[model samples]
Target: MSTEFHKLLFEISEALVTDELAALKFLSLDHVPRRKLEAIHEPKAFLEVLQEKDMIGAGNLFFLKELLYRIHRIDLLTAHLGSSREEMERELQVLGRAQVSAYRQLLYGIAEDLTSEDVRSVKFLLQKQLPKTKLQENASMLQVFLEMEINGIIKEDNLTMLKDILQRFRADIKKKIDAYEEKKKENYSREEVRYPVSVSVYPEEQGAEGEAAKQHGKIYKMKNNPHGYCLILNNHIFRNPRYNREGTLQDGEAVKRVFKWLQFETVEYMDLEGKKIYETIKEYSKKDHRNMDCFVCFIFSHGEKDKIKGVDDECVNIDDLVSCFTGTNCPSLAGKPKVFIIQACQGSVRHPSVAVESDCSGPLEVDASPLTSIPDKADILIGMATVEDYLSYRSRRTGSVYIQSLCEKMELLCPQREDLAAILTEVNNEVAKRELEGSKQMPKITSTLLKKLIFEVPQ
Candidate 1:
């Protein structure tokens, strides 16, 4: 490694705490032996072992970047690695690119998502399986998982104990494990079926040209490794507890999952201030997208007519956010697709984050508030959660109905390369069918897109 690169690793190593090192070890178990990882006491030693095994280096830093991303250390990525969360996410989509196993990532993600109380519950469930020392209060979830693996309780192919425990409190996280297992089984079945494999003389050339040229003749080009930045501005908490958008984080997660699957560099900014939202949007607009295809943004927060409210209760006009991507303002993305999905209420009748409807039997859901329109900029599309005078619904447990429903539709339809309009149309229909507070929410899709904006994901 170069001296500079060595210095970078040194800095990163110094930054990692003990718990993060445990996470790094657990995630890297597939590559590094269990016995080897257990002996590694510090970040520097662990990284050195990785370097010795050629898992990370100056030429191949993907694994290194992934480790930081796995531990939710985007600051290290930006400051030291000269990369961002968006950049790493885009890179992660490349075929066979990820060093960490999906099973391991899923476990680590669940561990991070769990609260202290949740961890205690998990430990209580595992008390009989592991020793007293391993299930202590001071023991982190990652450490508990290590104990499970050591005791032959859960493995790469067997996560029943973990799944059963998680399903009690976090069905969503448990569902992830189930999905992974299902996909694994599917892959096995496909391999056993013996599908035909065509071998072209110039496979690389044809594959590249075929993907780039097959955009239905007259549509926006969507042939980049990363289609574009899928920026998510989710404000879940405010200074005042009353204004907290409880389920907004779930919306951000849903958007990030779908867009990243579509091969976009998904970057999420949480609980941004009124001024910060504008700054973040403008910052992305200022980025050079010469190598990108389209830009997608999801702003899920509270707001009023033609405006969005930041965590600090500051208001930013919908037009101002859209203007940042105007042809003149953002020249690089001039003719490219710019999509903005807003999840908030629009009318003066502000919807409480959680509400107990008097007419209804239960206090089932809360709501987010907004209505928005783009400027006269061609190729810009805005999908508002609700129409000009209605409240949008959000779940304290799940997420906003608009965004979650949209992401579900995108995942279902995008495999066939569905256009943005078709996807949003499906979203509108799906969300419209639901009755919140015994009323309906009609999502508005304002489009100036001259050509169809289809997203072609990584193979």
Candidate 2:
């Protein structure tokens, strides 16, 4: 065997003996797949199977399985690994006249029940099967088993992979400890510095015309005065009346009104045809890195979960756009919040509005693709207009029900409450009560905020 393979074998053996049981118990709790567990039997056997099938190493197959189990629990494991009575009989027949012991049967039963069992129960079972001596003696082989089990547990947790959780957890703990130590070492004499915040508003279609419409309406107005450095990317090309294809003229009108109510500094009305939006965001994120506290992108366009459509009918993945502001590229906003407000549809799942006397508003349609990936460390707040599969309504006279309600709530609730989440909750409640009445779609708010954010200018 090659050095890397040999190292793998050694690691696997160690995992099996020392930490395999603990890891397996965790996996069982998460509901890892049987196939994944089976692969951990022996590296030689695994290699042989691969060789026979003309395959390579397990790749990410085992890792993925473990990851699923961790997020979902043991129910998934039973569903994937449980064998029918007929299949069991076939296996017995293949084994010839040899009778299977009760212990062996119990072991199989436990394996099958791995998904249903709790972490403690799994640990007990694993301990019964592999004693400490066996684990310690064959530590290398055990490592592989442990790795497989760990993967399964993480899977049940609904994560991308086991390695990610492990790495993140370790990093987070270390960071916390470091922060604590640093705090302790520092003197309390220096005055704290208050970070300055910048807000940018991007109105699509209607240019200054949209801004004019907002002034006419009875709506909550955002202050036009620029607080700090801000860049607004507006789609001026769509402002023309000729672009109204549906004949409803609703979108164009809404854009115009929203622009009127909106406030920002240095507005750039560029055609978001190709990858202009992504490139623009990238360039802006890089500019004035030292003074910038964070980055915000408010996109008002027709969109799905992964993509947003431009005026000239171009598609851009939200991930590609957001990646530009990550810690690796834009270190200024590393620990700071990166807020992205998306006023679009996620998917096609709509929920009926319930008739209730209570003040709380029911959920609207579930957005098709809810945010799947938002880094734990980075603060990312995503506010969607309507739930999945439902149309976000816009009146000829008034603006979108959700947006109108949001602005109203921001004006009223933000001053009293400093927390952004609390403000959003009020917005949700208001939108639900006002916009969701007799309507099918409900507005939604999703966030991965690292710390409490004060929306109103902090006193």
Candidate 3:
């Protein structure tokens, strides 16, 4: 082995044998040469102690051995100093399988009141050395090297090796981020402004007008906007597995029930005769190009992550529907906000009964296909019924848990709030608290909003 490699190994082994923390500090700061040690008032205190013990040798091995002995005494003095055992263990776990473990073991063994910041500083030292060690190893050496490699450290023959590795890593990450932005630009190049919104209501399934009336009041209050036009799409087809399929209500009847309760400037009941849901969204997206500031797509159907079933029993990919409004096709709304509110199950079943007392009730389901591709420049906000792998509820009595809370918040909260992000944060907190009460399903929102959205409807 080369003298440099041998010296490095001896220093590491001696440090490991000594107080690991001191060893880590020494190695991390490049051995802190003897001249630098003179700055301290007790410069030769450690060396004099070692000499009294009659242990002295020339070169690396002798000095390393004496240093290790001094470190051992220091370790004895500092033990019994930090927090509880559990907190120490958690910090160690975060450090993972690295050279830092040896130092942590020594530190925790001595201290009873060690602060988290202290532990982090020690870990940071080990993290810095990982890359330098990785680059110097041969293939055989590399295989046996046990130290975890720190990201962005590389071995090189040139003097500027460390600087080169850092620059390379930064450039690589930047390239990936830039590509993402370019794709977003290509997707929304049409118009610079657009407006889109989705409105959905599940009217009384049967003789439940009283419950529907309360929900209608909430929806009515939700619809009173001071800006932006509203396009409401109502789902009227009812198919109960318990009853004969042929006896279910027709489209006209379902539409009439919906119209009896809510009002909008342009309200259209989904024509579930034989057409696909994607086709319907595509048709509507093209209408009235004059009022494009944002885009809203509301879905009220049985859905899984990426798929939602239509009223006519056809399943559609949620991505297929969302693609129609991409920046590439709908330029008017490019870089504007695009919102999707889905009321569906991403999974198959609801949670079984629990003993805890609660008022919120719903199935634990996840939408199988939610938004797969999100635009970076354009603002996209997705509000789902539950977290991934849980059921969302649609009660025979109450409509949807998310919709109810959303409408209530819009009326009671939005009227008073100016910042949409703050409003949504409140909505997240409210839904989380309420849904956990009666059901296991909790509402969630994933957003990459580019600009602030204010829902004031134009008079």
Instruction: List the candidate 2 regions with Cα displacement exceeding 4 Å.
Output: 1-271, 348-368, 435-437, 456-459
Angstrom error of the Cα, residue 189, model 1: value is 49
Tens digit per residue, CA lDDT, model 1, 78-128? 898888998888877753456677878888887888999999999999878
**Candidate 3: global Cα-lDDT?**
0.43
What is the overall TM-score of model 2 with all chains considered together? 0.43
| Cα deviation of 429, candidate 3, in Å | 1.8
For candidate 2, give the lDDT of residue 140: 40
Ranking by TM-score: 1, 2, 3
What order do you get sorting by lDDT, best first? 1, 2, 3
Off by over 4 Å in 3: 1-229, 236-266, 271-275, 353-369, 375-377, 435-438, 457-459
Model 1 pairs in collision: 344-369, 344-370, 345-369, 345-370, 346-370, 353-366
Candidate 3 lDDT, tens digit per residue, 311-351? 55556776666665555334445455666666666665555
Error of 2 at 254 (Å): 11
Worst 10 residues of 3 by lDDT: 137-146
